[model samples]
Target: MFKTFVASALLISCASAISSFDSYKKSQKSNFTQEKSQFSDYKKAQQKAFSSYIKELEKYWKKPIMTSKKKLVSYAKDKKSRTIIDFGHNRLTIETLAKETQEAEQKLSLALVQAVTFNTEDFYNNDEFEQQLAKIEASHKIATPKIDAEPVLAPIFFKEQPTKKSLYHFVKHNITPEKIQIQKSSKIKTDKVYTLTISLPKDATIKRSFIYYEDVKREATRQQIPLALVFAIIHSESSFNPMARSYVPAYGLMQIVPRTAGIDAYYHLYKKKRLVGSSYLYNSKNNIKMGSAYLHVLYYKYLHHIKNPTSRLYCTIAAYNTGAGNVARAFVGTNDTYRAAQMINRLTPEEVYTRLLKDLRYSEAKRYLMKVRKRMKLYKKIYES
Candidate 1:
């Protein structure tokens, strides 16, 4: 009877253990199913959001076609608004407006290029030449001597007799012309006014429209970036104005924020010990160089694992406007700080781009990417042509 009781106890214990194991497995399966459902819902929401955004953007691009006269008048009153409206007025479509703007921009760019490229000899004339000579004289402290008296003859005594000598007396009286020294007045030092004439190949209005083409190209080449991409960035950033300053207090054509991207690029590429200040970015070349280098760093250092070149380029462009940290967050679908290398291993380039478009926190970054990509095509077309 005791033996029978032991067998029964062992069977009960084994039965309870199997039951617990089955319950654990069911709980695990239920949790996985719930997680899968949540992920599916999240993906659907993301798709919806992306779709709505694209539709809204399409509406904006198609805006001019349906723009009312009242709206045009309202836009026309503001100088800044009028320029955009005027470009679209004739085209009656966004494409035409873009083309019109591109053409106008190209004309202005060409005029500027010609102005900087043409030799200054064409502007040289007697008046300009004389002015330059005067400048040189003033700079060197050169002055002409003033002659106060005419040549005069004086009487000289030879032995015992006093005799009158003509002006030629220099030879007869042993008086040398060198002995009669002309008095030279001290140089009349005047404030030197430097006048520089910049002759534009076209009107001043057009020349002012495009000032920093060469600097953009030079820095773009030095950074090994596409010239069109640089131009697109400048077009989006500050429209190629070297003196541009943003509300963030970013400076120059590429709109560099010296404390952040500027310092990062300076240290990364230049390997400098000290950080360059904001004033340095006010220079057009410095701004472009730093901005482009920063973009390159984002592409290679942060987004390097993205296999698709175009996708990588787009992300890099967005990162330039936003920040790489935000980009990494978008990639991993997490707001929490995470490593890009770890996340990149799990995602394809297209997946990264889609995730960025759907998940990026900033609307401005989204708009920036679209505008830059659109403008890049325009720049390449206009530039090559």
Candidate 2:
């Protein structure tokens, strides 16, 4: 009887052990199935979220044209606002930026296509799924308004108008002062004023000489200022360097500054007299012509105010150096160099004019006048001879 009891106990223990192993295996299988279902749900959720975002963007893209004047204005403002960023801050160059913008547009278009193609039913099974499907269909059904419907392009939505500031910035960017030859003389005339002549190479070719001579002559004649004065001003400004620029962002041979020659002034001048290729301020001949005209105007103003032709020229040059207002104050004060210098010291933007004049080195206005006159006489003799 005792032996029978021991065998029965062993059998009961074995059965318990087998039952526990089966239970554990069943539990593991259940857990694995649950985890797989959860993973699938999570993946579907992720795809749905991405699809919703893309679909919403497409809705905007295909939205009916309800263009109000105000909306267009705002769009234009936003576009222009981006223009500053477009030019200034990107790691890449302008060409690269343009490429990037195109790529972004393409991405947006592709996103819309992907959103449309993605299975919406896989994301949801009930009312939510129906609502999303309806919304997507509605968005897709929305018609794209014609881009060319307007008789004239809206001002705000159109290409940005080039400002004087932009032109100035472009000029400064392109011209490097050090590379420019500010006062290169021609073989024909060794004067400060550059004369129109053939730019003969070290090995002269007649064809090249003729081509260069005609080009120079054409440029001179088109500018309305005497070729000699044009040369003189360029020599004074940038020494005949095509690539010449100034420390203060003055560009080209004539050193035209943005403040003086930008769009509003350019347009105003154009209304008064036609201009070519947007601006003459960058063109060597044009710059000299404009400067000469301005100098003549200053001379007239000085003669009216100061009553001396010779003194007027000096005052006008000084005025050009600083401004007419500063020069006026300088003249009205002591009329003596010491007093004029002392007076100029009191004005604003004084440093540039003072430094330039001091470097030129005249103790008095009379001497300054004499120097310019003497230079002008010498320039005429050299060029005319």
Candidate 3:
């Protein structure tokens, strides 16, 4: 009886496979005939649809919606179709074509398994649902599965819209380092205030420092950090000193600590080289660039927790004076701005405010800010003159 049942199951499975194959072949013939009719109908329907849309557009040519209509017209023209198909409004035609084609191919492919099954009994007596279950396994057998051609992911080709990397390349290429150095130096000199008290060497490229300053300032602007804050930091750190130094041996116009910030970063910080000394710190452009970059770093670090610009600026300044780690520590167990303020007050100014004098550290950071403002006025008066 078991042997008889197995034979019956095999006969039933074979019958089902034959029925499915016949149905699929019939579907293929139907689809082929329908495809020809559909394309013909599509051409007729497309003409009618496009004409109707163009008529509607002609009626509302000057309306606000006309902009979108114009785009539709341009796209239709690009498609170069005789039919007035409103493909933009109803994409069903193309979608239907894709759907029908995929279904036909899938069905035809599924029906073709019997030829292979006869040779290899591996697929014999497989249930219809079971065969579907093994579709992934069956897919591996296909030597060269159909792969529809796709456009390569190349960069957009627009005569008007140049590539971003190309733009960067063109900019770097067209403008020689020599030209950049000269132009940057010139811009700096024009913007910088020259003081007779500090005699600059005839051999120095003072303008290069200014170039670095401008680049730093532009970067700060792009980041949306208040220009006032950057200028204030420079004022407080070195009095816009370009050549300012401190007793602790903090160097550069920005008064950057070499050991902490690393010797390698100094090149990027100043954008120029100098003999190792405190006087190099006094260069106005280098000071501003490093000072701004440091400020930007602090701004980013505390940006998530703090929302208020004024408060964030204070914490950033505190972080600048005291290490960010200490400032972060001070915020432990409290998100209260006032509490953070108290912690900042308790932290020793000496650890952070290496460049600030006694008078500047007095009124929580307000006095420091006041000094920066005062020095900024002095810088403006000297430069603007």
The candidate scoring highest on TM-score is 1
Clash pairs (backbone) in predicted model 1 = none
Candidate 1 lands at a TM-score of 0.44
- State the lDDT of candidate 2 residue by residue for 1-385, as single tens digits: 9989999998998898899989977876676456445434533553575466445433322221111111110011111111000101111111001123334233323222222122212111212322343343334332112111111111111134435555445334423333222223222232221111111122221121221233334544653334444444444444333323343445444455544433223333343322222122334344544555555555553324444344444556555445555554543432344345443445443443454355433344434433444445655665556
lDDT score of residue 264 within candidate 2: 24
How close is every model to the real structure, measured as TM-score?
0.44, 0.31, 0.31
Off by over 4 Å in 1: 1-210, 334-351
Give the CA lDDT, 0 to 100, for residue 126 in model 3. 25
Per-residue lDDT of model 3, residues 1-385, tens digit only = 9999999999999999999999987986686465445434533453454455555544323221211210111112221111111211321011001123334222222222221111111211222211231342233221112211111111111123345555555334423323211111111232211100111232222222232445455746755566555554554554322333343446544567644432323434554322222222333344455556667666664433455555555557655665445444445533344455554455454422332233232344445544654554554443334
The better candidate by TM-score, 1 or 2, is 1
- Model 1, 45: alpha-carbon shift in Å? 48
Residue-level lDDT of model 1, residues 86-150, one tens digit each, is 11112111111112333423332322222222221211121222233334433333331221111
* Each model's total of backbone clashes: 0, 8, 15
Q: What value of lDDT does candidate 2 attain over all alpha carbons?
A: 0.36
Best lDDT goes to which candidate?
A: 1
Name the lDDT value of residue 54 in candidate 2: 45
lDDT of each: 0.49, 0.36, 0.38
Per-residue lDDT, model 2, residue 2, is 92
